[model samples]
Target: MENIQCFRPTKAVIDLQAIRDNVVHLKNMLQPEVQIIAVVKANAYGHGDIEVARTAMEAGATILAVATPDEAVHMREYFPQVGILVLGATPISFVPYAAANDIMLAVFSQEWVEQAAKQNIDRSLKLHIKIDTGMGRIGVSTRDELQQLYDAITAASHMLVDGVFTHFATADEEDTKYFDKQVKMFKDFLQLLPKKPRLVHVANTATSLIKDASLQFDAVRYGISMYGLAPSPYVETILPFPLRPAFSLQTELVYVKKIKAGQSVGYGATYTAEEDCYVGTLPIGYADGMIRKLCGQNVLVDGKFAPIIGRICMDQCMILLPTAYNIGEKVTLIGTQQGVTISIDDWAGKLETINYEVPCIITNRVPRIYSN
Candidate 1:
């Protein structure tokens, strides 16, 4: 299980098979020639990158995309031949390492190419030109800037422009107004290119799943949906096939007690029992990525809801149990129990954030157990 020691009952379970299945489903949905670049950045969104990337390649992914050059270097240890694309902007100083490691970088400025070309490297530097259609992130904003970057990279003796892409800022949003605008601009930008690079990608998980598949130029960068969580509710409604969630958080009750009526629980006595009730303590807290704001949330015990009480401590939290339960009873924080289930979306709603942030914040203190 990836050498993840779990002396504590809390753990995150990752289903590698679900990841592979997601890749296969997306692959089947795309055209035969369109590749799938599995995004394994942020440690595969905190599901463990190496395991997820391997599963993706076995299931039909042709390339792996990460957020940083360090991530690309780490992935290279696991995969020597699989193409690795650094989706985020890389420092010019790191260009030599990327070239030596066979990592493709996302280049947006002529200066980066000029800086990279000066490096005394034997291997050719591969690059993916990023155009700022509407994301307002790190990308060339105009046709002139795009051409300049393209021409500069082409002029470089050791730099190879392997791909060109743009990110959609509103693809996951319900309204297609901005989404369509970005798409149109991306298409316009594609026309500006002298010729399409080896990879001409414009679609991400949201666009690929909900938007038109024809927009998938040469490949689709699959991230959140590949982890079995929908990019957005709108995308979930239109998914051509079902996605199996690959992550689950689980723990067990370490201590149990019955408190008298009017007795307060946790720090500052935030919650007071109206009547006598059984309270269960779990060995998991904000330190393990379960933030204190989740105090009023619920965890599953005996297939029933147990409302969390009081301020969540550094290494522990209290839950008002339906009744007295065994100290070793199982608890489901983000997974199925009997029939009921709590999803990352539920936690995202609690945090007022996206589901992608929910799993990614789960710290390394909690061991991640992997299974097929």
Candidate 2:
């Protein structure tokens, strides 16, 4: 997959320097002793994982965290020495590979630990105990469960408890009541452990950015913010430093034509020209992750807003241009054009979703071009 070459005009431009700057800012904000776990899960939230991981490490991140065993293994192939942790549940079958590669697994259940220990592996598998303070996604819930899981891992000569962590459900919100409760529960669970692990991380991107420094503990997992995106609007307001967005969606107009009055553009004949106007077709559409809901959404053409007209097709979509633009004229979907910009947040607003989903939904059909 890495060797596949894409010759498409519609491509995602990734600024690696922005990723480096984000990591550097986060490193400066954390305590001197706190390690930064660069969460490069979901292909670095669709900015490309391996590249982001490398840039983040160069910028001071000490560990790379992914969501699945396959992602961790893929990263391990590129970075043999760097620590890679699987933040999600690992299949028992991956234990041998994880042990052999020195990858860490997030352990929450006694059953998973018992099954993992049965695998025939020559190396010790590093385990991170996950606590479910409130997210209810994964991890042990009660102090008893945490202590029992710790005991099982400690008893297994083939396994080592290297870290313990919890996810926050409200850390990105303005409200602190639920966030405070999760913190207290996590601390209480920590007290149950006979000996603390080398790492006791509890903060995600939101907590690391907006919460108190004490919550940072031994390390903080930097995720959404690592790509220069704030976890939420509330967190964005109180950011300790500015974030430089690293992703930009751009394409050139492939076809342009003038339509007379009453002529419609695109499928379903939804958009009919009331007067003579120009329409430009971009070489990207729903199949490229530009979903159809964005049909009336504004894109940048010649540094001005041009509304997407008609039903967004599978491979192409028409935009109502202010005038007839030459073929190959640049159109900005999620980036700056001249002095104007169409941000990811703007796309999120149009789609009624979060900013994180904007880039992630942009399919791999669009090649990601990295720029340092």
Candidate 3:
């Protein structure tokens, strides 16, 4: 086995400038008063949470959003003073933790309200209420039901309704009716409440792109678009500017050999050569988040497209390089060179999944190098 080189098919290049630039662009879209809740969840969509979070706040983010209380805790420990909100339900046991740290929680059920109230209310913890306008997920779902929770939270001196919001299921799709409906429901909640929250946000990245008024609150959570990735394929065609991909991945050619035609490669012998060609082995596979299903995918190498010619192994994969390619040549797994782009979109398309999950699944093992 080779003494695994550093560039061995397992590097994620994150562009800090792209992250900042995306925020600046989003800032341009918003009024001066509209604050941005930078969605740094899923390890900043696998761009490395702390790296992206610090960059986001430096670029005018007023708050940070995460999916779990644990993520909030991580943020609290890593980057203090930044407002962190757990955008989902939390158990009663963690209620004290949330209150203690002043980290906001999203309360959907009255049971959650009753539990939080049961806890000794010192000075009223900041809490955001999630309404299920149509996502069919964790949210109050109805104005009347929300009113009951609202009255209870209001009466409790220890729990202040800090914010009210909802999530959009298909805001990234071409249809806008569903998102508008959710917006109407959010507006209704605003009207129903005796006093509005200090922060009212429902619009995520896709909604922010299509609905200018969607950010009609103290803040809006900027997600995919904040990282310079398109909110959806549809938005790419209509967005005002070309968004640069903030992520790039690289893996260098480690071992290479010219295999004779008729030779099979890798576990299932998934690849059989048509002619004598060079094959480059990369020290990365499913364990590195490059799932076996992507074995047949194309990679940009030496200014040409090379195909992964074998079943991805535990920590190595084979790519059929062009005949002229030599050993030790660097390969671009996800990036642009000579005007050819191999982006997360390409990988997502190859895997029949969304771009969001593609980057998220990159996992934390791979080292992320930040740059301008």
Candidate 4:
């Protein structure tokens, strides 16, 4: 669907129904008692957070998870009553605001808990104890640390231990040795808690989809897969259910002209036409997150693949067309055109990055149009 307000030809189209379907499918695969914590961080992985969160909730997601307190607050504005969890560390100053807004925060250290307890807040602050089984990012590393933090939070009248969780370092990998170790460590941390919190989530999207059903404790943080993307190729090969991708980038050729042999194109004049072939200029470039590294990438044009040629400009780029194509012809940068498909994975492969970074890096300048 196109946005009437967007005058630019380049836009990112989002399929909200695909987001809904992904959540619904994940819900079906999980245990009946397990809750789906839809990870809508990074603006729902650049698909637009509020819209995806709504669709996920409608499809039975019970909670929303974000990477920062600001994101949680942003989500709270749109969803007044929906549960929001900050999956990352929070500033000591944000405690009062989080408590007042009923946003849950991930806590790791006893020092953080002590500092947060000092904040003069009237409402109870909900917290999820992050146990660092092996991620080496955040969370308490040992059972002793976990116990101290748990005790500190319990001692605070205005603080509540809402949940306890950990992140797996290699749930998406073929080798399960480290993954199994993380799982065991997380379980060990849980045992240290005098009583398990209401939520004991430990599985991320990869673990939830491919690991044992027992890992889906109370909830699973559904991130990349919720946007209809596999966490990795290993997980993709063994997915229990197919994911319907929600993001598609598109534009149109504003200028099409035949370049003579030996004629150069774009900045630095890197690409020169070896033969008399038509070169089409698209109204999308590095500024729109079609980075310079993607100059050699293929984009779908009228059911055929056209390679982007020359140095990508800030707001424009040239594609070496197979033949003479008229101006205003539709171009798909990351989507299906006719029967041909150009996926985010294609861009990832070209950029030598992961699929998660493809959509997230697409600048906000490119408006996202939503479709059911």
Runs in model 2 deviating more than 4 A are 1-6
Candidate 3 lDDT over 1-372, as tens digits, reads 112245445688889899898888888878769999999989999988888898889989979999988899999997778899999778777877788788998988876787778886465589898888889988887777898889878877678899988888878888878777877777877788888789888788877777677455678899998877887888887886657678988878888888899999999787898889888898677887899889779988877899987789888889887765656677888898677889899999889988888889886667788887
Q: Which ten residues in a row have the lowest lDDT in candidate 1?
A: 1-10
lDDT of 3: 0.83
TM-score of 4: 0.98
3 against 4, candidate with superior TM-score: 4
Q: How do the predictions measure up, each by TM-score?
A: 0.97, 0.98, 0.95, 0.98
Tens digits of lDDT, candidate 2, 1-372: 142465778999999999999999999988989999999988899999888899999999999999999999889999999999999988999999999999999999998888888899989899999999999899999877887888889888789999999999999999899999999999998888888899999999999998999999999999998898999999999999999999999999999999999998877799999999999999999999999999999999999999999999998999999988899899999999999999999999999999999999998888888888
Q: Give one digit per residue, the lDDT tens place, for model 4 in 188-258.
A: 77877788799999899999999999999999999999998999999999999999999999999999999
lDDT of each: 0.91, 0.92, 0.83, 0.92
Where in model 1 is the C-alpha error above 4 Å? Answer: 1-3
Instruction: Give the runs in model 4 whose Cα sits over 4 Å from its true position.
Output: 1-4
RMSD of 1: 1.2
lDDT tens string, model 1, 235-293?
78888899999999999999999999999999899889999999999999999999998
Candidate 3 error regions (>4 Å): 1-9, 324-326
How much does candidate 3 score in TM-score? 0.95
